[model samples]
Target: MTNSKVGHRIEELTTPAFLLDLVKVKSNCQGMLETCKAMGVSLRAQTKTHKTVEGAVLQTGGSRKGIVTSTIDECEFYADHGFDDILYGYPLIAHHMPRISALTRRLEKFHVMVDSKLAVETLIASQPPTGKTWSVFLKVDCGNNRAGVWWEDEESIILAHQLGSYSSLITFRGLYVHCGNSYYAKTDVEVEKVRDENIERLLNFVDRVKERGVTCETIGIGSTPSCKKPSDNMKKLDELHPGNYVFLDVQQSTLGSCIVDEIACRVATRIIGHYPKRNQMLIDCGFTGLTKQGEGMLVTGYGIIRDNPNLKICNMTQEIGYIEPLKGKLDFEKYPVGSLLFIFPWHSCATAAMHSVYYVIEEDKVVAEWKPTRGW
Candidate 1:
């Protein structure tokens, strides 16, 4: 379905279509690349947000390399499309060995992340594809409290030593932390504080490991909020892997990672019905189209209706959204039936994952349609 409607305006597209602003996407990708260069660190762009090959290519700045994927499917999809230096930045389990082993063999620089002794032991027990060693990254929990061994835990140091002990079977890559907690920050100052704190903790852990004589070839941390507003101290790290910056969302904007005008993705819907009696208009988008992720977080409800700040998405069903005004009445005359309305998603990643295809727009016209590779 590539370029399905190459020359049509977005208003002509079917309702509830996912739209990607090509220009904004390019700007976002280039900005991140330039940010990494200025910080003197590499950018291992994550592909979980927009999983299209075109987006990934733009992310890498046409290098076709240095990407960390969240799933084996994304890894294979990139590999199948000639992307190299891929990292399966997820916890390893015995169940994923076969596919991991294959990916390790297939790419020149494929790596996996692990946070447990079992993962290291699993890699030690299984031999890599003949001439390869199991490249592993120690996932460190630096305040995010998600995956990865805790940075302050003595067990974290022991785990690194354990991986070092088996040099023949496994190669300890480095530390990877997801600074997801940065999302909780209420202001830009708090976001930078979280970034600096996480970096300090991670570097301290690296020093402790160095005392034990374990070297971390690559050290990196990532979260859209942190990476987008990078601290000067981020230069100490070796890499930054952030995905959501490709399509800055309302959430990112609120975090000060980007302004609302920079958001590159939107759900294009239309007015399906008008109910002036109840002061509400019905849009052809619901939880399925825009997702219910940012519910109660934004005053506008599930998503921000572009160019219509007064219009609020008050409620939604599976395939319909109820819209009214923030204050008084919703003038149905201004929003006639069949008129198009674009919604900037609250969480671009969650919202993007719901759509099968993305309409690539430039100057209000659809120039291409990108089909993202789906599934875990």
Candidate 2:
């Protein structure tokens, strides 16, 4: 049944609405889940990309568990929805401990990540209620250099030992790393290469920690690009967490992680004006709608027009997106004022974050509305 509240047809919805293709979303989830199963790893579906209970349910295949969130709000949102096992995959903030402690008391298993002594110390300082010990993972910087202690650094081992020493307040769960560098790779081979290198470094870190007599229970690693086209060499890793695979964007497509057809989310907008002499068309979608993210290899524009990839969103203001022809001339009559268009975002995660709700579409009809948990 079509969701009457949001409108049945995509065109009927208000301009600058986020759209999620139900079929594509399910396929992406199933494909990644199968990939993890084949690689002998568990899929800890990252909810950071689509911070909605419905999307998380689909990503987890109705298990309503094994999730990785970027914020405490997401953790609380999912936990309230009966998602018991969750890993807050960000460096622990001392100020957020009160809420974290409250969540830990209720959840069956709520884990957090720490890359420094301060984070570990903070976790130790903030003790949960009785019978509650925080499950924690050491964020190891495999190669991305974004967060986490470097894999080769002895500090990781030191921190593991420190976390272990405070066994009553914290449990040193395992190691976690994000291969963010894979997003910069221009080809599938390079993406797989990054994945292999990241896994190798992660395993090396695990071994070094084990040599010190500490048993790392869960070795979690993944980025959407790496997991979508994982290297066959991935073995021994206990879990995989890839967020963007839920709704691949132009960036993933350009990186060869997923084909253009696999992009599941887009901004549905309407043409507001046309400038024939300037060869540009104005749309109601803007930075707040499509986001200003683009691929490293091609500076196509803010987003790719779903029907006409040649039309680039060259510039955008708060609510106005300027679409100009990247190649050849623009036909004004083809996209007159009020004409609706679907624009596949450059980065689905950022683009989706701009909207509060997604008009869930299946067979070109709105079947449901997914409300995302927003804010820090």
Q: Which candidate is the best by lDDT?
A: 1
Regions more than 4 Å wrong, model 2 = 1-7, 295-299
Q: CA lDDT of 256 in candidate 1?
A: 94
Model-by-model lDDT, in order? 0.92, 0.86
* Alpha-carbon TM-score of each model against the true structure: 0.98, 0.96
Instruction: Tell me the deviation in Å of residue 16 in model 1.
Output: 0.1
What does candidate 1's lDDT look like per residue over 1-376, in tens digits?
5547879998788879999999999999999999999989999999999999999999999999999999999999999999999999899999999999899898898999999989888998899997889888899999998899999999999999898878888888889989999999999999999998899999999999999999999999999999988777898899999999999999999999999999999999999998889999999999999889988898999889989999889899999999999998877889999999999999999999989989999989998888899877
Which residue pairs collide, candidate 2?
A: none
lDDT score of residue 320 within candidate 2: 95
